[model samples]
Target chain A: MSTRKQEFLAGARNTFPLLLGAFPFGLIYGALAVTSGLSVGAAMAMSAFVFAGSAQFIAVGLVAAHAPVLIIILTTLIVNLRHMLYSATLLPYLKKLPQTWRIPLAFGLTDETFAVAIHRFRKNDSSRFKHWYQFGSSLAMYLNWQLWCFLGLVLGDRIPDASGWGLDVAMPITFIGMLIPFVKNIPTVVCVLTAGAVSLLTLGMPYKLGIIVAAFMGILAGFITEQTGKKIQVEIQV
Target chain B: MTANEWLMILGMMGVTFGIRYFLLALADRIRMPSPVEVSLQYIPPAVLIAITLPAVILPHGEWHFSFTNPYLVAAVIAAGCGLLTKNLLATIACGLAAFFAYQILLSS
Candidate 1:
């Protein structure tokens, strides 16, 4: 296969698990959006336009609540601010790519795409094939997302929201599953616990700003813990 | 709604694409601070907790919690199942069952 084809294949392989996981989420979102008073068109449009699962979930909820358009937009911005950081982390590697490649790749960057791409990028130093890996990983996720959205739109209302379906919990369960593997150290543990506490305390904040605060606090806690660990190591060496 | 009614939808799409693509185009021109990178890691967990906590702690359509609240019980069961099985499908099944069982018990 050509280099591009090889990369696409690799991307598909890495994204297989993530794509499977996201399928139920798209279905759930479609069902929820319909029940939440969004027309099928709006629901499908959201899937097509936003292309971010969590953001779409939030958007549907906000629309249902009759939140002002500006507030809804602002909430979406805050919720997705983390993507900017994802962009920053990949900056060093992506900076070397052509503008055409970088722009398209950036549009394709989602949690699954970033997760798979970063794993590959960190595992090897094959600088020449960076875009190939990114393309491979992101393309699979992108296609998977679009496919699931389309399926959901077609059969969403008929899916039936019930306990037996158990699709609503897919998202939360997926997140917990993802988090467990990453909580490999004391710093990560501390950050999660501290953030959880803060988020709980500020749960009533309007517009979901508490989420932003909790995330900020968790990041701060993680950074501080890392700095402290480094200081101790330096002290011991001295 | 008709296609003509979807001008707003197209606008939303334009805005989204702008956010995703604009940052990449501007990456070389501007640098993000160290703090921004640090905070990004916590976003997923924080957002997850934020969304989940209200569903459990706050009863639907009410600000307070009570024993009658099935979501709370279901959430506890769900969390336990999540830790034990470490399987998404299994955990969700457990949670959904617990939630419905509570609702059914209360109604009956």
Candidate 2:
């Protein structure tokens, strides 16, 4: 096999575990999209085009609630703000690649791909094919998401009340599962607590602005905590 | 899709792609500040918690903090599973099973 092909396969293989977690989420998005009155084609198109799982779920909810187009766009933009961080982190490594390679890779840089790609980039290998590895992981996740989404769309048509069945609860559970491993420090704990409390307090906000507000507040709180924690550590060292 | 729905999808397409493509395209030109870089580290946990809390705590658009709120119960169970196993599949499985069992018991 070519070196590029090997890197790609390795990337896909590394992403397999993450794909297991994403499968159910993608399926839920598909079913929920249909439940939210999106046509099958539109729902599939979203999975194809937008390709961001959390944003897609939020979009479906906004659509179901008859939110304005501007609101949906803004809400999704808020939910996807984390992508900028991912982009910033990966930028240095991708700077050498041409636009042709960078564009598609950026388009495929989902959370799962970012995790896998960053890990690979941090390795001390001199291979020029690292981007190919990212491409592999991205392709694997992209294809896996599309497959599960299509299955969900098909099943969604059969089960009209999929949302009512409380399967949607899995989404929050999944997020909690994803969140716990990251709570390794006071800053992270503070971030999660602030975000959770604020989201609960702002539950009645219009157009789901509560989430956007809570997210920004949480980020701010965590940022403050992280800076203070560093200062304390520096003082202790002195 | 209606024209409006199509517009929303297309609009989302443009915005989502725009965000992902923005910084990477300009990576060579702009350097991220240290403060912003530190803050970005918290974005994932903050955003995920912000999104998840409302759904788990207020599933029906109302505050349901009691035992009848299967989502809250299951979310707690899922968090426990996450802490113990630190495994995604295990956490999700435990959560779904807890939710289904709660549904059955409550309905009965």
Candidate 3:
């Protein structure tokens, strides 16, 4: 196999673990989207175009609620704001690629892909085929999401209460599982704790604005904690 | 789909794609501030926690911290397993099993 093919396969292989978690999540989103009054076409279109799982989920909910278009747009934007950070983080590694590669890669960037791609990028392999690896991971995830969503849409039609099956619980459980491995230091712990607490407290907020608020608060808390810790270390040294 | 729904979907596609592509498009011309760079490291955990906590702790959009709330109980078990094993499949399986088992117990 060529080096590009090898790197591509490596990307797909490394993403297999994350795909397992995302599959069920995508299924739930599809079923819920249909149940929430989205047409099958719309649900699939959002999955294809928006391509952000959490944002799509929230969008379907907003549609069901008969929320105004502006609200749906704003809410989805807030939910997906993390992608900007992802873009920023990956920008340095991706700067060398042409527009053709960068456009698709940007569109393919999701939480799962970002996790795996960043790992691959940090290796700083001397090979010119690193972007192919990321492309492989992105393509795998994108296709996996569409397939599961289609299954869920079909299943949702036959079973009206699929969302009520408590399958949605898996989403949070999976997230917590992902979150646990990252809590290796005080800053991370503080970030998660603050975000969790704020989200819980603001659970009743309309349009799920609480999520955005909590995200900002958590980032702020983590930044301040790190800065203060650094200052204290400086003071102690002096 | 209704025209209104189509509009929403298109608008979302625009916004989401715009955000993901923005920094990459300007990769050479722009530099992220140091503070923003440091804080970006925390975003994955913070955003994930923010999204997950509400769903786990309040599956029904209300406070359900009592033992009878299977989601709350199952989530704690799942988090414990995740911490102990650091395995994705195990964590999900343990969580689903706990949730279903709790549901059975509740009905019984």
Candidate 4:
């Protein structure tokens, strides 16, 4: 196989597991966007432009609530701030990539894309193929997302309403599936509890500001727990 | 005109692209604080739970702390199944089953 083909193959292999999650999630997004009163064009366009699943869900909720557009924009910012970290993690590997390859790759850096690509890069222990691997993984995920989302929009009306089809269960179920893998550390456990409590407490807040509050509180709680752990580790060494 | 909507979407896209690219461009010029790194690591699980729990338990916009709410029961089962199996499909199936079963029991 040619070097390019090899890189693409490696990318596909790395992203296959991520696609398992993205397919259903994108379907849920498409179905929700349609049922939430978005035009099929708008829904598909959103997948093309925004491409962030959770942010799109929040946008649908805001649309349903008749929220001001400014608030929607602000909420999207806060919710997606974590993408900065993804960009940060990939920066070292991407330093040598030309602008032609960088912009599209940056747009495709969703949670699953970053996870699979980073995992591959770490496992490979080589920077030579990092960009190629990332490109491949992200391309697969991007294509998978667009296809499922389009399918969902096309078949959206046929699917039963949220109450009838139990489609409302998708988000929570997906989240639960994600959470199971990360509860190993005490810091993570504390972060979940603190964020949950904070979110519930602030549920009455307006314009989904509660999400922002919960996010900040959760981050603080996690940092404290991590620091405490590190301090204990140091003392133990001493 | 509703053309404004498209403009708004495009403008928002610009803003988003700017934020994401800002750090990508600055990655070499600066180092993130230790606290910032620690906090970013915790964001996924925290945000996921924050978004999920309310939707499941507060389907009616109020806390219905009872077994009568089928969605909550289904969510708990789904969460357990997910934790045990670590599969999205399995978790969603359990949730769907619990939701429909509770709905049936409620009607009966």
Tell me, what's the RMSD of every candidate? 4.5, 3.4, 2.7, 3.9
lDDT preference between candidates 2 and 3, better one: 3
Over A1-238, each residue of candidate 1 has an lDDT whose tens digit, in order, gives 2376676688678667667668887877776776767777777767666677877777778777876666666766766666665676677667767788987787777766776676566565554676787887777777777787767766766766531354554454444444444455777777777777787777668656776677667767877887798899999999
> lDDT: which is higher, 1 or 2?
2
Range of the 10 consecutive residues with the lowest summed lDDT in candidate 4 chain A? A162-171
lDDT, candidate 3, at A111: 81
- Once fitted onto the true fold, the runs of candidate 2 whose alpha carbons sit more than 4 angstroms away are A1-7, A10-25, A28-38, A57-75, A111-134, B1-6
Candidate 1, clashing residue pairs? A11-A136, A11-A137
Provide the TM-score of the second chain in candidate 3. 0.87
Candidate 1: Cα lDDT at B5: 24
Q: How close is candidate 2 to the true structure, as a TM-score?
A: 0.82
Provide the lowest-lDDT 10-residue window in model 1 chain B. B4-13
Q: Write the per-residue lDDT of candidate 3 for residues A1-238, one digit (tens) a residue.
A: 3499999999998777667778778888988887788888989988988899888988888888888899899988877887887888787788878888889999998887886777677774588888899999999999999999999998877876777778778778777766776678898889889988998888778767787789889989998999999999999999
What TM-score number comes out for model 4? Answer: 0.78
TM-score of each: 0.76, 0.82, 0.88, 0.78
**Error of model 1, residue A63, in angstroms:** 4.1
For model 4, how does the per-residue alpha-carbon lDDT over A43-62 read when each residue is reduced to its tens digit? 77777787777777777677
lDDT, candidate 3, residue A183? 78
lDDT of 4 at A206: 68
Q: The CA-based lDDT of model 1 is what?
A: 0.67
Q: Estimate, for each residue in A7-120, the C-alpha lDDT of model 2 and write its tens digit.
A: 999999977766776777777888888778889889999889989998898899888999999888887786676777678778778988888988999889887787667768
DockQ of 2: 0.62
Rate residue A61 of model 1 by lDDT: 80
Better of 2 and 4 by DockQ: 2
